[model samples]
Target: MTKWKAVIFGFILAVMVKSFFAQYEFVGLLIVGFITGYLAHDGAIGGMWNAAVAGALGTIVCAILFIIIATLGGSLFGIFGGLTGFTLSGITSITVIIGYLIYYAIVMGITGAFGGALASKK
Candidate 1:
């Protein structure tokens, strides 16, 4: 229950923060991870895993949203409208997005783990 709550809270906060201050996204993600970890505290090990998953989930959700928005905009406007604004398509674009997802997952997961470790109840 606590873990789920933390995950939902973290996800919501992640979206809300990104919607407003899109520039400082990493910082907001870290803060959300920390708060989620702190809220879902169990033991160091459990907390770390839960928090890391929550953080990664947030990143995945954000990436999905980005893809959706970019696809819609690119289709309507005849351009790739994502962060990179690349015109690349097919395998190359897939590779880029996959790489981005992996990178973001690791980065966000690490921050969450650190937070969980520090805030562990046991």
Candidate 2:
């Protein structure tokens, strides 16, 4: 498959896994990584780079979806009170979430690269 196909597959797979198994969301990333790497290998491309790109794309898509959901839920539930209150706690929460997302993406990318390396060896 092409790189775009791999990216789309990874994104959908990640989203589905995350939605169905919230507790084991990392598994979704791992699966995406593996699939992307395998596809890259089959395509005779740079397996590591392609897999990493797929991982990044999948993670980014998932993060954006989560952010949208969180924003809507917060607005509907009025979880943060007023803007003033949100300014403080919200900043911290957002920062933490962003940090976690970045870390998650990096880890997933590394995992993808590993999978790509394994595939290339075969």
Candidate 3:
């Protein structure tokens, strides 16, 4: 297939996957993006390792962003008296972090697979 087709198809796949998971889980969109990217490209064992590293980085970034946004949202609600209070603690905190990690990992893995394939001439 042409490079343009691969990119377009990858993007569509990413968006669809993102849409499907976003409602059910957080960080779905980014995960989908990573997966789309990885799948669209090419790689090897070393590439997988690179993907894992990238995935971890992506997860951390998403998790941090989520936490910040969530915290800000909660604070805003509290200020508006829409909510009494919101906080991440213990299991809730852990779960959120882990969820982000998993989502990113899946995304990275998928993207890496695609990337690896694309990178190869044959």
Candidate 4:
């Protein structure tokens, strides 16, 4: 499979896994990294880089989706408004989301690289 396809597939898999087993979110991410690394493995291309790219992309997609869902849910349920009655502002929410995106990219990227390297051995 192509890199983009692998990224998409990994993202979907991660989301499904997280939804079903919220406590094992890291395991889902690790699985996604492994799958992407396996799929992108080529004798010429480095598996680590491929897997890292896939992980980063997948995590970014997840972050975006999460932000969208949170925004909708907050609007519909007024969830954000009840938070100490301080009300979460748009800037604060955006900042938090961006921080999470970076955190996910770095953490998941390393995991993916490791998985890709392992897959490359065989």
Model 1, 1-122: lDDT tens digits are: 33788777876786676678779977877777677667666544555555566655666677677667766666445444543454345446667556655654455556666667777645
Question: What is the alpha-carbon lDDT for the whole of candidate 2?
Answer: 0.61
Candidate achieving the largest lDDT: 1
- In model 1, pairs of residues that clash are none
Ranking by TM-score: 1, 2, 4, 3
As a TM-score, model 2 comes out at: 0.63
lDDT of 4 by residue, 1-122 (tens): 24666566666676676567768877766667667666665422444455556555655666666655665565444655343232445456667657755654555556666656666676
Off by over 4 Å in 2: 42-45, 75-90
Superior by lDDT: candidate 2 or candidate 3: 2
- Cα lDDT of model 2 by residue, 1-122, tens digit: 34677656665776676667778777766777677666666433454456556655655666667655555555544644443455556556766666655655565566666666777684
lDDT of all predictions, in order shown? 0.64, 0.61, 0.49, 0.59
Ranking by lDDT: 1, 2, 4, 3
Lowest-scoring 10 consecutive residues by lDDT in candidate 4?
81-90
Worst 10 contiguous positions by lDDT, candidate 2: 76-85
Clash count per candidate: 0, 0, 17, 0
The TM-score, computed over Cα atoms with residue i paired to residue i, of candidate 4 is 0.63
Clashes of 1: 0
Q: Each model's TM-score, in the order given?
A: 0.67, 0.63, 0.48, 0.63
Misplaced by over 4 Å in model 1 are 75-90
